[model samples]
Target: MSHGYPKEGFNLVGSWDDWKSFVPLSRSGQSGSFVARVPIRRPPGLEEFQILQGQDWAARYYPTARGEGVEGPGNAHGRNFRVTPLPSDCMQLEILWDVLGRKVTWKFLNAAEQEIQAGEKKVAAKKGAKARSAPRNQASNRGPFFLVGSWDNWKGFAEFLPFGDSFRTKVKVGLDMKRVEFQVVVARDWNRRFHPTSSGDGLAGPDVGHGLNWRAEVGGKKWLEVTWSPDRAPYVEWTFPDPADAHEAAAEDFAAMLRDLAKEGSGAWFRGMAGIFEALPKCQRSSPYGAKAENEATARCLLATFLRDLETMADPRGPAPGGQRGALKELEEQCEQLLKDTVGEIDYATAGGDFMQEALPVDPATGPVQLKLWHRLVYLPLVMYVRNTVHLYEMLERLKAQSSGAGRGRLRALLDAKGTARESPYSWLVFSIVGALQILYHARAAAEKRGGCDAFPLELLASSPPQTVWIQDGVEWSPSHGSGAGAFQRKQVVNCEPMKPLGTLRKGDGLMYRGIWLPADADEDTIRYQYSFQSFSRSIEGVMRVLRFYSGVASTKAGEAARAGHILMYIGVKFQGWRLAMASWQ
Candidate 1:
């Protein structure tokens, strides 16, 4: 696998593009055109040959095309090729390349990160995998959540759901999903056009120029001709060996059936709920007979209607309820109409309206976090995901402080002496940086690997979301600033909540330790107002990021053992509490 980035040590050209090719030019004793003929140990063939400046390529005729073109004995090693360089202003390049000389072999490894991920998913699906499920910090509960394979056995698409959600997601059953698998390997940038007659000397015969790309057998047969490129990006180019439109129409029909089945399921659930409402055992026992009977009758009717719809839709592949196939068109129109009417009747509040006002004023804490500004400045910065990246450096710093004699021994603070400086743990994230480095080093062996840049775009956001909530009207939600007419008295923050006070999120200033800074006369209704990013956890997070990037250690990256070490060393140092070093950047 290749390493990521164009940095020294691991990079081929280390820190820059555009290599300087050194060529020694020799002038013949008598020259008409002053030709600078660069001697060739072996012909560069078409791939490495390019006509730049005043240069040209042609056949240096061979008599028998064997043993330097000599017909007689001692001629098994036949013809040789040379690059013709002429006099002109353009830069002329000539080269005799081999594994040794100025040539650095570069090999590009496969770039698909999905391979390892798929493997992990399969491992997680095992009957008894040792993976532990971590608790989620999510606040809301409703979800289209299902776990396939991830942290805490999390899997599937979970973008809408934050990392803070639950410890685990429900298991959605269907399709025997765990068993479905597909693997593809694409050998990109390899020479697809090389003749078997050219190469010799235990090297690839001319056709060997393409070299060993890679192979993936799908369905137990070799999948061939899959393509990849510098211009188009590598991808599995399997030509759907099955056939064009093979079962596509049937697949679409099946999908439609599945959708109908889901709707039926929902209908069944609602109908059953109606039955429960109609037969409220408590109501039947406590309420009058007439009222009980009336409620029961209404519930039964609702339940019956639902059951009828359910029965009609059973075996989703069947016809419509009214025996009118293709009634979906009319039903869609009716549904659209109902949506429009319902929307028309709805009265959503406009921005800056009176309801937007907070119902109760924030009780001025004898502490901080009273105003919206405070929440934004102090609290919002606190909830940072302590990852081993440049993203959360500053917040990590704050987490270390927030007490008397703070900043003594947070893991990062201690690591400042031991940790690296100003670079991501690219070496630590092996899967992320491995392929590019391999390409950087092995470019010569494989004809397809030459002359390409290694830098790639980052996969995740530069930073995490805000931790503390920022608001002006606390008791109720509002859009307007404070002091509005007919507006209810409210503090910026209804509450001064704390996630982890001393854990991080502090101004580099010991002054913030002035503790909330509420006025002497400040009461429950007093609004707390903070004013600077210096007070934010974001700043601390920033510092931590720089530290992580610099360290580049693999084992110590955001792992639990690593985290415990950080906290132990940090709190132990600062608070003089306890000292324990769990993990190091290995």
Candidate 2:
């Protein structure tokens, strides 16, 4: 609902506050509506509150005369709006303000579970049926049922306590959990597991048919109730917090991660980037066209901006007085040197060697042959690339003690060669870089600005030939890219082209590549950098190709047979391997 007529905002003053220290409501991203989720910490009972404009009792909101039992003059001193308690931890307070008459209207809603049930009711009504509740029957399990899911890394078996005709267990979810998938197993047996019958909610029955994993949106919930009995549907009662609150919770968790990293050993790198990290997750916004493309472009530019900024901050010649070396100068130099050593002096023209030369024949008339840096980068052994990257991170940690600006803020390397500790598929370098870029991108979006120049504040660094640099469309040659010398200036990248959908599938598809003009401000002509943006696009295209293959060659019955045959063949291979291994042991 609304706030102070047309002036600033308003707060919800109630019995909980003793009519003092009013709770302010935030704008709900709507025109004239404001909302707040007021926590009910005490006993559930009648809650009395009134809309107080700017925390002033002189301009309080009361029940409208149109409301039943609302009597007398609906003025500042009128009766307070009343609400009976419902089964909820918090109450949703919505206020609508009308500037014309300085009128105020509000309503209370049971926040979490009730909101979900209300939606369920609407869905059931549309299907011309009444909403159904989980059936309760007294039945004993053959053995103890164990809970296994993401909450416990799918390894530990948390046994359920016996309940009336069913086994029930309390799942305490982590604060960072966005979604959770789980299953109940009897006697800790994987084969005797329960799954969702249809692909929606969970069902428990004899393992005779295929089923999907039982899943639910945790949405920042701290606890869940999972109940199941034999020959019945398994039920998981999930407590989903308010969506806005959930978003805030997730953002706080991500910020905590960044703060922890800052405290570890790369303090200089994260020095003035705290505010940016805190605002990154909130940068997501809905657009007319889906947000996927927007997210991708933002992600790409963000990565570019982060790498550029890191290079600038770690430059040997710092912007600080006396031309002092940067705090990360040593780390930067070591990493750059390591990269150069690993890849060697890359000559893009001759990097591809015989294979690339034969693939793309160059005419003698066309001066210098153009080549893609991407090809060279990808062609290099992935193991070598990752190994070198890991080495760079290790060097950063080792040199942190001698580094200046701030210490104990080093980003940890995720790729641990010694498998003593757990590690993620993505390395810590990727995480740190991605986090920094997100901050810059969101900060730029909030400022309502476009273009790489505005999005990234750091002066574009200078790059010599034989070094790889990404250039987007709409680039124009300028005297200098940044303030420094030997820098080639070019027009800033504002927008990226939307990703196109894969057309009709073919038996085989090659790399769909394109050529880009590499800016050379000094010379009138610029060499083209050939690359493929469709590398990632091929994954989805491959899936579509398989689907089209089946659709073209087989009928529904035959398609099902083919799928079954594939599964049987896969199982047979596994069995054969097991037999061979056993024979080898003998």
Candidate 3:
């Protein structure tokens, strides 16, 4: 038999597990004709069957009275086609189906091709079928579909209103429910359920089982829109554009924002850091390195506590804390030993000038003086702190830059009010120290090239052996070795370009030397100790400004002298009267 639409296929569904155990009819070489042969059996009598278009029950051929050639209010009650009982002797039967104009007809024949019975039925015209049959841009006649899920215990379906080529529904999900899962069903039938694939496109399959349910957060006021092409084979999309109950003001929102930023080349490290920040209690959200004064004060107290903890770990006189020692505890012990032994009895005032002028001594016999264990202990935590802090700062700056109007106002307020440094002291210190280390390492490397010591500081000092780290769509480099040496090594960790500072000979655009990421924009002082010294100077100035602000010192020369006095006392440096003249008051 032939159909009006030749490309459309039909399935044979009947009373015996009709939905599950169905047969597909084969199209005849003659245009739209379709044919299928069946072998009759006893026990469960085969009395009724429906010719469904592909897997869609909504587009089935409903059997009608002989001459009623159209589907409407007249033939709305037509059920599945009934079959006449076959003779006891007969076993095989062949069926033929065809549609002509508005009428559909089917007939059964014996093996000899003799017609046993014949029936003629009218095809149901879709609602407003005439308009639908017009030009491509005309209004469509496809009826609405329904949604079914755990909401109604899967017993009944909910209707979706048509809008252009899509269908939409406003579902009332319980406010207390964590999530809602459902699927689109056509014609309230089990055989025509649209289950989503991994890619979110809908496909007709068996019962829409658990885990196969299209899931969405239910505690929010959400609008679900499903788009489909009427003339095409089954392809459907379900999207939720806005969720009214989204927790934008919560920590999870910031975490999600960080995750998104990490999708860009330079942001992968933010993923793990974001988790740590998200887990922090709201009261502890502020970092000492933060921009706002109040948060910074809280951070300072926290830092003091952290330092005290370190001192306890360092003191051989005291027992270490119980439980498995973490990275911080291990580091504290290393720093404690280094402080007590390696640089013992040295005054910062006397040593500061030498450390600043002589770049640590490297013996010609050994490559470079192995960095003290304290450097390793201090390095990792400082790296983590600097990375997390800088990431937070960059995120806020980008948000403030991108937002406008009321959004911009709110972000601007957050930018100004948050305890994040506009020029991060923690980041500056981290950069400066790491830069100084890099310079010392490279100097030793250069000297080794000229028949000097072959030892490298980073290689000797790094906690883990050098390994290449990869960034998605970005350059790669080793963290424990200087740039050119490990550019081709295979082992990789993070997924972002290694930091490459401006005016450097490095091939990449980011740095992760010695397990610490250095900002690409900061100037590195490889020759004249200008950048590191300037960074240290600025940091001291920042501390002085903070002291003056807290002390309520009015802008004056005496107030400046007091702030200078605080710094000179802390660093154990002599206050040269002429140098004090150069200090700027806030």
Candidate 4:
């Protein structure tokens, strides 16, 4: 039927047994005209049948004015067109429905013309039919089924290749055809066939009505492979592994792990714990010694609460025992309370002493021993707290990336709020703990130094070497003296070269001028500079080699001076605004 509604199409419906279902009319080759040829069988003594314009009774058509041979008065609800049984066995009735005018017209063709059209249809069907061969692997007792579709010109069925657990076939669809429709039939038996859903797209379940065909739109590529899996419901899927299905499966597995952890501790709990560790940033897990006791406990509690809420909210049975909105809020309240309780229990005075005794059993009778014990206790947990906070930050970031939908809105919001590197509560906690530990370490070190025994040598506290070092070329003269007035005074001409700008540096490397330490500006540089005096033996030997070349100094005396750790002082020369300096041994 032609419809003025323009947006939606309508189907034909009637009271006859054969017309109970909707039959769509063709609009091809006609302007605003919907045409259909309905074949009706009249049983003996059958008087009349009713025909309507739409699938629903509400949309049924009614006559606006009475016409010749038309029966019945129309009403607001609906009106049925009257049908008269012809004397022949069956008749082909042609109908034209105009939706805009709310009118329908129909007429029966002469018996002679109907017979001629029926004969022509049969001839065309015979010409289009072609016998298709069965697959080589087909069972002898069972006949072969084949795939038939518009893509193949409706000529005949094509055989499918037998493969492990499935049947497959490749077909080429024409680029010009915007869409193609097809079905699978068993040994030319239409009744035993696979059809698409009513919309002629997607795989149809067994519960779907019959006679519909599957359809696919043409892609840029011409070649397509189709597969059928008897074991799988709907029996068909396109392309390769479905990305939506894969993503859904991963989400399900994550949810299942959370559920297991919430319900009880078992193998599933261990697996879930592994997932927590896996979610941590790689850098956090790199340390040989793992997390501190208190931080680890906090992390476990946070994870447990977070997972419990996620599982409860996502439960299929609906949020009941644990309401969606309250679950996370309750957990957050509990965590805040726990933080308060734990912080109250910290006794700073006894905490440091207790930690020192627990970390190291050695008696702090000596200054050095007390200092050693304090350093261990303070540094160990400081490292661990930093790592745990980092792990927690990374876990939150991962959850934020994966979260979606209204159900997870609160969680996403919380993650976004706490995701900052600078003001996050976890970061603040780590910073406060580390600062406290450093204060404790320094206080204990100062106390030990006040005692009679030497705590640690201050002379050992020299800056580390610069990463990149260069040897000097030009020789400069310098005066050197040590241990006595005017003793072994000499004018030393040492090699010098301009220092290169700093880049990436490694251990055992430094900037040098005439084989001596050249300190880069310490005020502006973040990297500590190492003095050559720290490696006394090597520095003296290097200077001695230069002295031997310039002066006739005895090898024995130079070796003695190197072993004694006494080196001649070098002076700086302002060359091209760069600090060029060197050391010499007397």
Candidate 5:
């Protein structure tokens, strides 16, 4: 078993020497010590050992350190010296020690210049000057060999590992095996050219005799994602530090752009939100998870709607630059703020102290059928989606900023054309269609180059809270009495719950945050109900009764100002509609 060991179980044509041979005499078989060694000698010309002994290779294994979260002892290492066998079959080994057994091992191609020198005992003579002489090359990616799994579309595998740079996951302790580990490799660029394979690809390998686990520390605390494995895969995909930090970074970018918009006085931001509202009902849809898709859809639609309105006000109608645009600008700023707060919440969840593992929900009908497929098909994709939106919004804001000073008159022609032309609501359909075409276009090239399709736009799905709503619950109604008039389309489940906006409540602001959930065989007259706060009075948190209003939570009698207030009270006897809906949901 050389440095480039092919997981456990596969036999190497080496000396009968077990781990004890290379281990220091005083530290052999002992766990959690710098001096102790686990021996798996690499035989020259042996393919298995050859991989580990590439140019230079050395490794150390230790039990999962205490408070290393759920996973167990892991190993990290790098190449030091190339060890070559002598006439008596004695192999020369080069060992470079590092912190907490995290280091690189070297097995150079050179034979023992003299007799095989024995490794000196460092742990035994605690605090020895020579032992302390080892320099801490913190830059080395080598560590006790651990594995982690990540669902990478490019690699088609979560735990794919390559030689030069390695995110090769180390195993976790006290648990079964999984795969995928991200340890520091000697070369930073090694990750790009590695041999990547996905779980569905049937890329099976070894199970560690012990678990492998480590935490990427930040600000003195492990991340909120406590990744662990329960099987031989030895892989768990985790964003070290925190997933929120990443999200906030994206949000900050988006918010900064909004500030630019505020300064530019571009009505585009406001009109975009107005467009979102206008387009929402038309494209309202649901997923099988019971998520109405309304909330996320509303966000999109409102955003688009507001943009349209702002542009309209800027040109075709109202004053060129007055209170009209100002009001819309304020709304635009609010949306930006909403998005920012969402990122903050995202950070909060990942940082929450939840030790239990969660079963990621998946659409069995159209999901990846492999280990942690939900992540590739869903989680990471959503992260990318949120991030992309942030980027796009920023771009939009910046563009508006640059165009602001031109005066509404310059953009008048463009605005007039839009007002009269066919306005297509921005929806995932366009993105999906385009993405599919791109996938097809890349298929041939990908096949030839062995690279996965990187241009697929499968990010239409939002990675919001996995909410569940069903046809039994009935959909919300619009101001007009009508079924099928949902925030999104119907005929499936919806995933979402009452999103309690963490501030004071307002009339017509938004119903208890729930998405749409349509049932199969649903069509033009099917009704779906949702619960809402019955503001009998303006007191927030008032003991609102449950009610089950019909589809299209809209009433013509409660038109105009009602759109801003009494969104729930006018639907039906407040507290009454919710009761019926809750019973059905139950």
Candidate 6:
């Protein structure tokens, strides 16, 4: 509506001119109304138009509410006005401005001067009587509106009944449907349908059919309450069935039971995986320690047996009793064949070199090669388990990232560790226990392959024994041993009961222990084993250096050639002649 703009400024912009040209509106004499006459040749069903002031969009007249013949924005905003012209040869449109609202109230008339459609109806009330609203049950003058959508395969329609100046109807809607697209139409005609102005609500853009249908999410509701009126656009609301209806209640109960069962099944699968990881080490230990020679005859077959058992336990059917399952039996057989055909004929160092170089079987070029007992059973199985475990951890990290609300908080609490431990201790324990089994298997296999001479002492492989020390009043008796360890525990404090690693145990000690050590004043050492890969790597490197030098020296002896060979194989490297240098010893 033009507030104070000149009447000559108002012009009609419509689809008849492709909305590119504005047709000037002439001022009606003395009525202060602006009018535009549609020529007899201009045929119309529904015509889109807008009234602009001074031919500028910034001053265009938009309808704040839909009136009788004009369809304004319904459930949408910033939409052009649309109206259906009567079948008459010519029609005239008159507009009155609402200055405060900056909108237009319009009416169209046929040549007979009879009103066709009015934007709003003005009611006259008696002077001494109470004002009354228009009749609610009266149907629209145009035609009955019908509701159509995927609910009925888009074949049929549900007629809307007038209710308090608006049309409404109830239709059955399934909660499981992913999309429920529908529209309001007059007499069930596609040519006279209503659609949402916003395209993002599961609707296509202007290039599609007549327009995009209105979409509803349904969202676990049995019935949808659809409504349409002049003032507001067509929209839907959820309408649940009566709670006392036994059939409806039974359906809801069944759905809830299904949800609970699904949750239980998922939980069981996760717990089963955790149990499998926990049992892997114990299963390896239960196999006779070094009796593979008598049963399998070769280290290769013995290692294959271990791999078969490991994969069998992870099968969905359940943990295998002890040996091979059908899942990976063929792969296990191939590993045995490959090792037996290649091990003694080729350089054994090549097998060890490949295994160490590709700790993971990620390189496609070398992944299928299994030439030694270590490669087939020890390294391959360990790497496979580690890789799969990493995948599971990655999935858990993604779940943690996407999780929100109470569920996210609970998941975070379950996955995260408290205090200094950044991650769950159980996760670390799985890796440590699995690595230990592989180490033991490798040692036993290597020794057997070298005729039982290529064996290293347990003390050489393990960490330094924790030395006993004492503390009083938060002061250590032997700080010189170095308290660089990650943690410690107090066995006894003079007359006090034994305490956990707390306050003084962490502050007073200077030496990091391989395990819990007893106080110097205690009756005996209370060893608590705790080890890591970093410690083992350092220890093994030193032992290899010493064994290499000794092997070189022993090679010169009269009948010690076999002993020297075993020594070289055990350390997995050759002595490049000892050099006298400060860095070499360090």
- Sort order, lDDT high to low: 6, 3, 2, 4, 5, 1
Judged by whole-model lDDT over C-alpha atoms, candidate 6 comes out at 0.37
Q: Write the per-residue lDDT of candidate 2 for residues 364-422, one digit (tens) a residue.
A: 23232343322222211121122212222222222221111111221122121111111
The residue ranges of model 1 lying beyond 4 angstroms of the native Cα positions read: 1-475, 478-488, 492-586
Candidate with maximal lDDT = 6
Residue-pair clashes per prediction, in order, are 67, 18, 20, 4, 138, 5
Model 4 vs. true fold: TM: 0.18
Per-candidate alpha-carbon RMSD to the true structure: 36.0, 26.1, 30.7, 39.9, 28.6, 34.8
Q: What TM-score quantifies how close candidate 5 is to the native fold? A: 0.19
User: Candidate 3, residues 257-307: lDDT per residue as tens digits?
Assistant: 334433432122222222333323221222211222222222222232233
Model 3 whole-model lDDT (C-alpha atoms): 0.36
Give the poorly placed runs of model 5, Cα more than 4 Å off: 1-221, 224-239, 242-251, 263-266, 281-283, 286-478, 481-586
**Residue 345 lDDT, candidate 4, scale 0-100:** 29
lDDT of 5 by residue, 117-148 (tens): 33311111111111112212111111112233
| Cα lDDT computed for each candidate against the true fold | 0.22, 0.36, 0.36, 0.35, 0.25, 0.37
Which pairs clash (backbone N, Cα, C closer than 3 Å) in model 4?
463-530, 464-530, 467-505, 476-494
lDDT agreement of model 2 with the native: 0.36
Q: Give the range where candidate 6 is weakest over 10 consecutive residues by summed lDDT.
A: 523-532
Report the error of model 5 at residue 32, Å: 74
TM-score of 6: 0.18
What is the TM-score of each predicted model, taking all chains together? Answer: 0.14, 0.25, 0.19, 0.18, 0.19, 0.18
Best-matching candidate per TM-score? 2
Alpha-carbon runs more than 4 Å astray in model 2: 1-7, 11-33, 36-82, 87-91, 99-104, 107-232, 235-325, 329-586
lDDT of 5 at 305: 27
Give the higher-lDDT candidate: 4 or 5.
4
